[model samples]
Target chain A: MTAENVTAADPDTTVRAPVPSERRGPSSSAPRMLWGLVVLVAVSALALTTDGFVSVANARAILSSVSFTGILAVGTVVIMLSGNLFSLSIGTSAAVSSMLFLYLLPDVGFVLAVLLTLVAGYATFALQGAIVGRLDGNAIIVTIGAGALQVGAVTWLLPGSVQVPDGVDIGFLTRSVLGLPFPLYVFLAVALLVQCWLHYSATGRQVELVGENKAAARAAGLPTGKLVTVAFAVAGLCTAITGILLAGFNQNANLAVSGTFTFDAIAAAIVGGSSVIGGRGSAARAVLGAVIIATIANMLLLRGFGTGVRVLVEGIVVVLVVVAAQRRKRSIA
Target chain B: MTTRPGMARLARRSRRGGLPYVLLVVMLLVFVVLPVVAGQQVTSFNYYNLFQVFASLGLLSVALGLTMIAGEFDLSVLGTYAFAGLVAVKLGADDPVVGLLAALVLAALIGALQGALVAWFRLPSAAVSLGVYIALLGLTATISDSKTVPYNNLNVSDVLDRQYLEIFSLRSIIAILAVAAIAVTMTYTRFGRDVRAIGSDRRASLRIGVRVDSILVVLFVLSALLSALGGSMLALSLAAATPDPGFDPLIFALTAVLLGGVSLRGGTGTVLGIAAGILTLSLLRELLTVLATPTYVSSLATGGLLLVVAFAAAPGLNAWWLSMRRPTKRVAEPPSLSRVG
Candidate 1:
């Protein structure tokens, strides 16, 4: 899970080598710095102007809301670094794992069900990674197919919502600490570890190398297939974690709201300065993206917009951010 | 990498005559022969039901196939379907023809807007169109008030409802005509050649003086317009519209495009092939439903087909595997090695 950054300093592993521009683009602090300031200004303005924006309860709500998307974004960033673009299947992965977690909870109890779900998540995503990387399949179609398969399976097999067992103590996963839910800590911990690995580890650098140029990476003797597989596996693990925690947060396993999570995660990653072209950004930035989306979504709610409006607003924001990111990339090139 | 599959298919097609017939035979086995044998569904198959289902998705797959021919993904076609359907159903309460024209024009304009972003502004078609899609979905829901409109009040268009021999509807005929128009355009027109040429190699097309960006815009607009037609036909057939039709139709459309052997990487295949794909899926769904299986199972099958179609279409796995077998095959890097060494 952790990469060895020290080993990444081999003469051939130099970051300053003739890597793709996206690999070097992150080294310049301009786009990231601009994003941070924009987020800061937006937050300050909202806090100053809105009535309930600064409340601890709203802050807590925002934190809880962002945990799933934030964690998902971290995984998406890794896949992007590998240059596969995205997995449209992340939402389905969450829904499948969460539904499976609930389904198995009554039968296998808690720990075992959670464990089984984690494995399922890994296998599901790993299959996609294998097909896309090993067989050189298109990422978009593979992911879209995988997503449809997962959702259809759940719909056909599970059919409806399942409740948590009465005696299973699911309270621990969502219990509050310092005005924030436990899930927030989980998100932060995952982001911290991923940030460290991506910025300071050998495998992390290899992931970048593969993403920056699959051909170049292969020419340089890197194991491109295995690295890509690992990236998807990481995404699956994160999605599975989110799934289990969501069951705890909602006190039930549900499939009614399976639409927005995957797109939101991709939006967060793009907003956080991660290039869809791969080999850029960090988990820390993805965390920033999640927070930004959360704040905007929360703000829309506070302003009396319906759920539909909120979704529309999120799409507008993503479009704007992607356009800006594209402009920046073009300028840098 | 994205273009590899389509390019490979074109390459293979050039080297072999009658390959398309072989593919058509394979498609028949999957779409017709297998379903008939597995469930005896052929006798139970209703022509009206089949063509009704075919009317919407068939157009959608053809529309999507055209864009893929032009070397881009149009995830927004589904979005256009919903949006244009929303407009037509809402406005048709007064006049159906006006509603149809409005939907078509708006759909085309919306498509052109997205195409401008991809062509003029140089945005990634997938991501940008995805944003457009999500937004359109949300807008459709919002404008429709998040409820299924009964649509009982609207006067049905006489043209859309006109029946031929009590089996073939005018709407289905229109859909077939649209497909024919697109096929003729792709096969016989300079625009068609340029679109395929652009998909095969954009830079080369540009170097040969094709108006690459404008042609891309036209292809996108055509896709959008057809998607709207599909939606309008759906509204007419169902006599209702839902805020969300979900994505089952989109998946089926994509599956049809792939199954009919249209390449996702673009610049290959035919309207006839895409129609065959649509027929396969539409009939498959009808068979599954008639067999007392849940409708969701069709979606599951759709997912499976997506993977299979994408895999089959690539046409490059053997060559790629051969290359993989040869390690240390370091093709030399061009100069500017070591950053301008």
Candidate 2:
């Protein structure tokens, strides 16, 4: 549903708080901005110490690499904020979406293929949402099952990687715009849009309300189920966007297109201080989280550290952030 | 005497509602009988193959089921499996027992650490276990250097795989014994009751003095040990280990646990049911192989079965179905009166 429908339906409820004060107050933003600054300073110092880390080429590389996962992390924030925990099937969904896009690209034009792929992704995740929200199924388990089903169906139907047709030139999708990769722009745009939606839209605020306290929201006669479905549908759209960009960048798609995206996005979301307990977090924060992770990995790469080390650090960061967040919440309570 | 009636009634109802047993029988009939009816010879070898596939994954299902029964999750099982396999292959070049012990010990340590974090902080088990999962995966990759590690001794594989009584192998026998032991512990011990209670309601269990934290730690340790044992045996049997064992086993284990009627909300399910669930899966795999279907079909079947089972077990759907069957009763009782006197 659009913002207008929500406004029209709840005209009398406008006197109530539009957004949760804790989320947008200066007290919260000040600490968060300071943390961001600290990370930036640390990264800058590391860049200065490392050879070629400060180059424009390296900056572009980092942004380009973070774009797909950044978009995915933003999507994950939506589901996490909806109190569904995390979707283990995000990587699989992205893979399936990309494969569908490629499969359709040969038959249809690029635009139509992308549109169809987006619809398929949204439908798949929306069904999962309905199961979780309406059927009261466990979100984590349902998503896990959905992911496995997606992978199984994809592998069964398309035995191998799907590639762009020989005559089709979709290079423009991956091309750099104003010295930045196209995906980076898309990532920024998505982050900005979702951030605005969460802050400005009535439906988005209801989603946060449901996440914050499902029982309370239900008692208040909110459409909690529909809000959850909307959150998941929005997540699906973000993943579809990621998949489309990924396929464009690679010129091919397969089951392994973004196998690690699920964990990576989750790590980014957690590290960005998104409350895993739900009702807290922002798309912009998730974007910043993605950038922080990518920058750290880039630094590790420049330092000759292995993928194992990078992954280990990422895991450690997630644990630390989760623990820290738990402590903070406990103290607040 | 009042409590006796309620307890007896509960027991009787559980026995009557044997979903797992019924599902297992249906699955066996479909997978086994259909093949034979199609003119295929159902040999002891097929049973052996079925058990062989069941050996490792069955243990994983049990491991995951234990944690689920205790109201937690252990995504680290997959990572531990791969890591243990790699460790066993890399360390047990001379003595298999030594490598298995080392792997199990390390897994126990990892499990204990995770349990401590979850219990001490009252953290979400899924999130904590996920972090552990990623870290263990990193460890596995580091140890194996992203390559397959092969055991130098082929004799160990031969011995583990050698058929006994025309149907059972040493590994399969061990797996069954372990499952039986755990089932006995869970069904007959006070510890089992505590775990179930915790799953059903953590606060209530704590109020009743269940030692929730210590039990949680123990359960996690047991889960990790089972997974490591399974991984070690599989590696010894196959004579090789890899950095990545793929997520197929994780999905299979999860599907088996759910099929066993373990509610994701926790507090229900039997170990016997879990065993049946694993067997059902094993039989399905064997049937697909016999039918000469593509490997992807197995994935599709398992995944689809998982979704179907989950959907079927949904509380909302069950309530809706109940209401549909007894619409008059639903209309007669107000919702508030149903909960309060």
Candidate 3:
């Protein structure tokens, strides 16, 4: 029996429960130890696999990759916590943002273009959230439809062919600042801030409660609908930020690439141990998951795996991580 | 139990089944009237074009519906479709029949294994199947070198293309067969009820002694086999197997199924509803094409349609308004399923 259950049980009615509870505490610690072992082993494997996996260069690469995805994952984590299975528009949001940023770079500086894209992404996601949160609709379908519309809009709005302008290419943005790439530093800072907010803030606690049991949360007086909408809007902001970084990395914005990020972000978040059924995720895991995926992908590319094989491996890893997480959750419960 | 007047009104509406029927009628009319409103010839062409698109796409939708009914999502439809198509093309050398059978069986095996993993291990279907999709997509590319194989032999296409006796329509016949088979399984088979029961309530089904895991595994296998069959047929019809036929079909099939009023929650949809969904979406696409909408515009329309239908079908807005307008204490909790999915 759990410690909570033992305390909840009547003293006279559950005399034997104390015996189990005494044993359960030591056993419960084992799971915590196991979590530590998993992290230790994963870090070790990453260190051993690549020559400089622990080096500044590798760390920067990992951070850059994780930041964009981590930002998106944070948003998705909120939605997932709210009990939604998937958010469909993130990919299109990213694509639209990237395309818009690229198209506008000539007219505006890269930074302003990025800001504009972020606002657009936030607005679009807010719209999606409102529709999902307010109007009774399938989250998957609504976002997917919205995504498609956005992709189409981007395609029409931008000139033919899917490449970024030369002005916005990686030359200026790729340089390291303060011993770490700007993107990586940005991602870490965001992760720390979000983690603090989600852990300590009243709104964070309310969001968690909403995720855990919407009925109960509502009963306790919470703005469940608006909360869900905000979560989606946050996800949009993450997607837009990711798109900007991605545009910098590629030195070109491509809609095709943007579409893949949709599932990639989901996979990364899930692999890092985010729950699909919702109400469980952390910025740390979100970033960790993105790192793991990006590492694996980078390795596959280095190993010269065909596109098909690389995708397959990446997919398998995602499934395995999710399955493992689910099994763990079930066993613990 | 005492209830307010508004609550009583809502209860009464639930008892009346008019809403569903009205929605169906409206959708049908949209498909029929909207195209004609644009232009007459275009609408008529859409009727014929609609059949081809439906035959190709409906196969995957039905397959997805089966899995959806079992309360799981498989994102591997794209890969499986591609895998099956590639298999057919590679084996088309000796005999078209051999090639066809090979593709179907390979796909079935892959499906069964995936289904087994998902059900037996209780793995998330989306996650597991996505892995399968990626692996199969890789396998297809590695095996076929990412290029399409064209079988120029007219004999093979001729044999696979037409309905029996040249009088019947091939695509139409397949559509009928698929619908019939699914209908029979759903309406008559014990297995079908088992699936529905599990979908309706997994815990309750388990308590009632249903073999929830085994039944789901079988359902996944069956769904995969059907998807593979669809891919193979498409390959035979087109006389070429490319690496990407599967990719396009998956999303479109999903849109069709959801639009058909099959609850994504599972266990509440019908083959007829699915058919209507497919026909409606496909016809709309054809209508758009006939209207000379650009390719990008066409896709945008598809997405827009999905959003409209999603909102209209479920209406989260009402739920939000109810939650916000009513005092927090007086408002009952939103339905748990409604909030999550």
Per TM-score, the best of the predicted structures is 2
Give Cα distance to truth, residue B211, candidate 2, Å: 1.0
lDDT of 3 at A274: 69
Note the DockQ of each predicted structure. Answer: 0.31, 0.32, 0.38
Which candidate would rank higher by lDDT, 1 or 2? 2
Residues B1-341 of candidate 1 have per-residue lDDT tens digits of 97999999888776433343455556445655665566656542355656766678888888888888777887888888878777888887777778788989999998898887778756777777777877787788788777876566434745666667766788888888888888898889998889988887776787889997799888889999999999977885577776677666677787788777666667777777777777767766766765667767777788998888777665446545656786433222222234433
Q: Determine which window of 10 residues in candidate 2 chain B has minimal summed lDDT.
A: B329-338
CA lDDT, every model vs. true structure: 0.77, 0.83, 0.69
Best by DockQ: 3
What interface RMSD does every candidate have? Answer: 7.5, 7.3, 7.2
| Tens-digit lDDT track of model 1 for A23-107 | 3565556875786688679766975687688887898889899999999999898888888888877887887788899889988
lDDT of 2 by residue, B80-186 (tens): 88888988988898999899999999999988988888887778888888888887877777777878888989999998999999999999998889889999999
TM-score of chain B alone in model 1? 0.84
Clashes of 2: 0
Off by over 4 Å in 3: A1-75, A108-111, A161-170, A328-333, B1-46, B144-154, B163-168, B245-248, B315-341
Q: What digit string (tens of lDDT, one per residue) describes model 2 on residues A213-290?
A: 675565466777688888998899999998998889999999888667888899988888788868689998898789
Q: After superposition, how far is residue A330 of candidate 3 from its true place, in Å?
A: 6.1
Model no. 3, DockQ: 0.38
